[model samples]
Target: LLELRILLHGPAGSGKSSFINSVDTLVDAVSHDSFTTEYKTNKIQKGEPGTFYPFVFTDIMGLEKDTNKGVGVEDIKLAMKGNIKDGYKFKPASTISKDDHSYNNNPTLNDKVHVLVCVVPANTIHLLSNETVTKMRDVRLAARDMGIPQLAILTKIDEACPEVKRDLRNVYKSKSLKKKEFSVSLGIPLNCMFPVKNYHSEITTDDNIDTLILSALRQMTDFGEDFVNNLYRPTSSLQTGI
Candidate 1:
């Protein structure tokens, strides 16, 4: 019985859009029994048929290594504060401000991002450009400054490790997972990280994939609740698991 805004930030080709589609497919399968895994629509609000997510997941454009391309750090910071409106065109070198037409001058708590979920592809962690990593880190720091709780979703695990691709249950023991940089650089701990495989080639819903997706989402909601409710009452409860 809780709803919180979850903002997704990531680099290009990191599967942010695909992850949202996966959530929609999983909801259809678990709640109903019909889901089609066709090509990715690359659209937002692609979740459950005739259903809406209680908590909104805002997907911004991908970030680039330099300020000259992709999403700017300032724009992301503004987004975390819920200032940027939906469908607002992003500028590579400029960040939105109070004067921007799309800026939400008065954002409610619901409009602001309660949970910040950083999206990074597991397979490319080793190959990330230093500038990209640095820029992402800057975004993370901005979130931290505002006391916003953070979690990261490690997407495309199947492509990262063959063992994981075969059986997702073996994710924890897979020695090949690129967990170091995420844990150390982004400050997302080993426990906070949720490694998931987005639905790409398959048509049917897999329990393993669904579980991973839902589990991560569940935690996101929990943390979001923790941040929002704690604002009014700090010592409610800390035990939220699915």
Candidate 2:
């Protein structure tokens, strides 16, 4: 049995790493001034020992304003197809080639991304560079062509909306978010986007935060399972004769 692989890609400081830490306590050390320069896969441990959730998450270097300053679009495309291996350092100059030691000669279904999740900071969504948005769209197109399920997590909702900052429950009712505008800007459907504030300075978890994170996670697993199941589904129709 293979765990479903969910790939998270977004611009630097979008809270991709923080989101992972919030969900599974897998710390990747998020920094606004720096970018994650490696490809890493994270797993959620269950209550029991030597056991984990059925799904895993893979995070790549954050997308940047320039292709040469951050993760290459080609590299993200390669990752979607499972061409890149874990612990591989990202090189903004160029994508990994088949000749590279980190390249996977043959990636199985498990190695391929079952779900493609785009993590974007709610506060900085409007400030995203045109080049970065284009790169994101390019990666999204690749994932779509591969028939991978996709979703977008809008992180740092509290910072984006004052109402939500006061009360987490008002997240949906807050008018300041302008979900439609962001949906159009990011190229992700309004329904596919989920907004949540990642745990930052909190010494412990909060029920409200956990609720939002778990909701998104549930959808991730659901979409991932559907994608994997559909792969084995028969393309031809079955006929029954009386």
Candidate 3:
């Protein structure tokens, strides 16, 4: 059993929230048509692996280059340092600082961000202007500095390739059709990238979609476990760069 904390990052409207929703749907193996009840509050959300997943996913506000909107680079640095606490609403106009109550002055291995998942929409990856790419690069370099392993999720595959849209079984083979959307152009290694489609418009679980999404989830969980397990090198190492 592996335990880790995964963070989802990307530009606004890239479907981070939708991806989380899809994963929750898959873990419970629940279809919208058969959902029996809804919990008003999610203080203790549970997942797969009997009691709950050994790991959990964290979704934060999107990143934008603008100084007055979206998550700031400084805030992202804080997140990578594991200083930001859960449920801390990100203020687009400002970044997190030591003054904030949610700031974790001394984060432990449990508080550190184990995995960094970059979510990008495949359909419009080319349209991700240099400004956006620059922002991503800045964050990537920051994560790289902290020894955090990052993975790119090239999402919205259904809208990127025709064959994949018709049938996800052709994802890897359809890379030619989706060559432009590939993360190689984004400076990320091809092996560390994944293509997935969220179930935003679906009412039922489609095996192909689940297969792709779950595969990515499993791969990310593995990467996260590696980082968390490695944190035992020394307690001081975790707080050095912060």
Model 3's C-alpha root-mean-square deviation from the true structure amounts to: 5.4
- Encode model 3's per-residue lDDT on 1-242: one tens digit a residue: 23477777777777776777788777554323211111011111465344666677666777665668677777878877778887676777777768888888997766667888888988877777677778788888888988898888888989888888998899888864454446566677877888899987887888998888888888888888777656654665654432
Sequence-dependent TM-score of model 2? 0.92
List where candidate 2 sits over 4 angstroms from the true fold: 26-34, 236-242
Models sorted by lDDT, best on top: 2, 1, 3
Q: What are the clashing pairs of model 2?
A: none
What's model 1's TM-score? 0.85
Which ten residues in a row are the worst by lDDT in model 1? 33-42
- Pairs of residues at least 3 apart in sequence or in different chains that clash in candidate 1: none
Query: Per-residue lDDT for 112 in model 2?
Result: 87
Q: What is the C-alpha lDDT of each candidate?
A: 0.77, 0.85, 0.73
Better of 1 and 2 by TM-score: 2
Tens digits of per-residue lDDT for model 2 on 60-125? Answer: 899999758889999998899889999999999988988999999898777889999999998889
